[model samples]
Target: MEQTLRETIRNNPKKILGVNPNDAKVSLSYLTVAFVSLLIGGILGMLQGLERAGLIQLPSWLNYYQVLTAHGLLLLVVFTATFTIGYQYANLSHSFGGLLSKVRKLAWIGFALMLIGVVMVTVMIVLNEASVLYTFYPPLAAHPIFYIGLVFVVLGIWACCFGVFINYRYWRKNHPGQTTPILAFFAMGVFILWFFASIGVTIEVFTLIPWSMGLVETTNVMVGRTLFWWFGHTLVNIWYLVATSAWYVIVPKIIGGRHFSEKLIRLVIILLVILNIPGGFHHQIVDPGISQSVKFLHVFMSLSIAVPSLMTAFAMFFVLERTGRKLGGKGLLGWLKKLPWGDVRFLAPMIAMISFIPGGAGGIVNTSNQLNQVIHNTMWVVGHFHITVGVSVVLTFFGICYWLIPYLSKRQLTPKMNKIGVIQTYVWTVGMALMAGSMHIVGLLGDPRRTSDTTYGGHEIAVSWIPYEMVFAIGATLLLIGVIIQVYAVFNMMFFAPKGHTEFPVAEPEDDATPAPLWTERWGLWIVLLIAVISMAYVVPIVDMILNAPPGSPPIRTW
Candidate 1:
């Protein structure tokens, strides 16, 4: 039966179309998506960046709204979805003992559907038919077909979710009572998060589509935003969680050490599942409709979410320290000096950690209701997320691909260029640091986020910060160049690298390692449920206020 199944998978045209087509097939797919998505998104990002710098003329017909919408939706859909698919394919093959033919067919179907959705949305935006800024906040409506395209995108994501679940079940059946691989468990958590997080979008599509088509009189923006954040905030965590898993698996190997505490790592994952979902209300800090009490409750929970993130920092640093000590390094800073400085593995995590520091701090400030007043909708906001998601997560993705591609393709990376890529990683990190720092300062000085130009406190500020803007532009260019270099290196390794058939040494199978306990399995699902409960607890009364408060309820101020 196993033989027949393997043969079928190997022979099926659609199932095998993209699989192992060459040494670089899997890596190239992921790199291609990242490159293209970043390219498109980056162009829009550059416009936004330049506008913030006050260096560009605002074109009236540019339709900033549509550009913003397309940029956000495309990046979210392509960057996360494509990277997840590629990583999971490699992860499943290793974790599940082997990949099945059926799973491959499902993945292909999912990829195709996602591509169609991207095309539909892109075309709509280009035609100026949809300008809803990715939020699709109703009453600010878009073409019905825009919503339909989103449906296709979600459908495609659902297919990928099912594929992951099936693969998990298959692995568990074959290796009963064994602990699940950490990477597989993390992927499963993300899929489960998607299953629940997508509910809000699903509701929007079903009800809002009809409403937009003129079948209903009104659509509630408040309800939509609430439901949307329930999905949105958790989706961000989903991206962070997957990227963190790469950190967990790769950090130890890169530093040449073992995980400091497996149980602690698992516990953090559990906490992430629990806290990440409920904390979406932090995004609504500035909205007046929500009560102060409810907002405060979210503030408290948002601060709590930081605990696990800190725990991850601790675990990672501890492991690196241990690895340094093992290599005969001395004190606190001594370990840093001994790291394999030139290796992509070491460079990736190091840069990710450095970028995350400021990003995390900025996140704290933005989530505070009072503090948000100062920086909300400012360039600082842009700087924060780019560091967190763009610099940190994207860089780590490259790191993992760098390590994995060589192994999967049975080829060694071109040595000299790989080192150069590592150096460029630092250059990019420094550039972002300078750019984000300048943006934060300017934001405090009262520059608005997402605007082409602004006057603050009834006066037009001189272009005193043009120099900083120039520096930021330089940084942005350098960052792009760095990314391009990494892509070129990966491309060469994947396609043109001479395939000297070398069987890399595989790790010894762990007999004692049982599949992760079932009670601990699907932890992310329970986390989603908990988040829903918390969000509803805080959000229900806020909804009541919008629905029942007389023409003017006494403005409640708790801060």
Candidate 2:
């Protein structure tokens, strides 16, 4: 019976079809580092949350802002970016049969560079030499090593991207007229986005490296920020795209359904590529130096990208409904009850999807020029992201890890532990609900963000915010509990779980009525479009800032 099950899994069309077992271990090398960064970053984040609650005091040696910076860079940059690449390799293995020597070598190069950079930047943060926060915009420069380390990290990623493309190019040559495997398409979309998005940061960091090293005395703060946001806003969408790939490509099969439209999936990826770059300008709406026309353009463009998300929501419903009805479900929403809620794989992404609904609304609010002014930089902004990236993206990733860790490590995720994974998801969702919800309300109430002490003016309105803070503290504690369990489950799966095998499950997609278009494969055209849109939105602003910019501020490490 066990052999039959293994054979069935091996023969499944939608399953991760890949090469040697050794290739999987190579892919996991990157994932291992990512998990390590996530754990450390999560711990720092909990410390930050507790300090906010006044539950405990961090050592004077470890300042709040420094911890904040570490938390942001480690999780957002180190963990997410590395994880995306590793997962790309995993997905690639589904098509390539296994990684070639070049691919493996490049993967290791990327990993080494990233690990070294992370360690250097981390040490700098611990010594309080690089607390410019994650943005690190000048004239508040970081240590030279910090900026240089970032450059190494970016180069590492680019090498990995190069490796993926090489395999892709080779694959296309051999499989002419075949639609690229969906998993392969997913990887191309992700790395193409990364390739374009990294351009801005590459330039931004190069500029900072010189200044940090004292080669240039002054740097335009405006240009620096403009460059960073050009990179920053898209970074959020990159993570979104990564998580959504799993949702779109594998999710249907999870519920015993097929993709609704392969063509639609391709369109969604294309739209994200073209629309997401222009959307970055929305992040800079509040800056006095940026043009109103540009910000307005960004508002519409950013809002435009949200349409694909809406499409995803509907398609997901259709898949769920169809699958549930086939499984004997009935009524308007009864199919939802028929979902495999007990499986942590489904449960994690489900909670993430549910949480993103509110987060999406908050994004619209933030995009508005006038509306954003009302809550900009308040805890509302914090709450919004806590829901979006914090809850949605992070939860999805953790959920993926539940299956991924065991599959990659050849460890068994016991039935009992699967229940523990599900519990962790709910605990996180509930805690985020309380924490992020209160943040939105308090943000609207005008509580400032990124500050340690809340006391000010001593007015009644100011005093009223304390209860929410206490509630937030309670939520934070609950969230940390979930984090602990999630991390423990991961390490348990990696090192201590009984040896066993689990397949990388791929769900059946609903048969598409319309065939995927040939143009969807024309990645070059879309890449050109992406470049054009980004340049159109940013070129004038960046050039204008450089030609007639404000004086650069000198570096400061003030707490």
For lDDT, the strongest prediction is 2
Q: Please list the residue runs of candidate 2 whose C-alpha ends up more than 4 Å from where it truly belongs after superposition.
A: 1-19, 457-459, 511-514
Candidate 1 global TM-score: 0.86
- Each model's lDDT: 0.69, 0.82
Best by TM-score: 2
What TM-score against the true fold does each predicted structure earn?
A: 0.86, 0.94
Q: Candidate 1, residue 380: CA error in Å?
A: 1.6
Error of 1 at 360 (Å): 1.7
Clashes of 2: 8
lDDT over C-alpha atoms for residue 252 of model 2? 68
Clashing pairs in 1: 178-514, 178-515, 179-514, 179-515, 179-516, 180-515, 180-516, 377-449, 378-449
Query: Per-residue lDDT tens digits of candidate 2, residues 104-169?
Result: 888888888888888889999998999888888677778999988888888898988898898888
Model 2: how far residue 364 lies from native, Å? 0.8
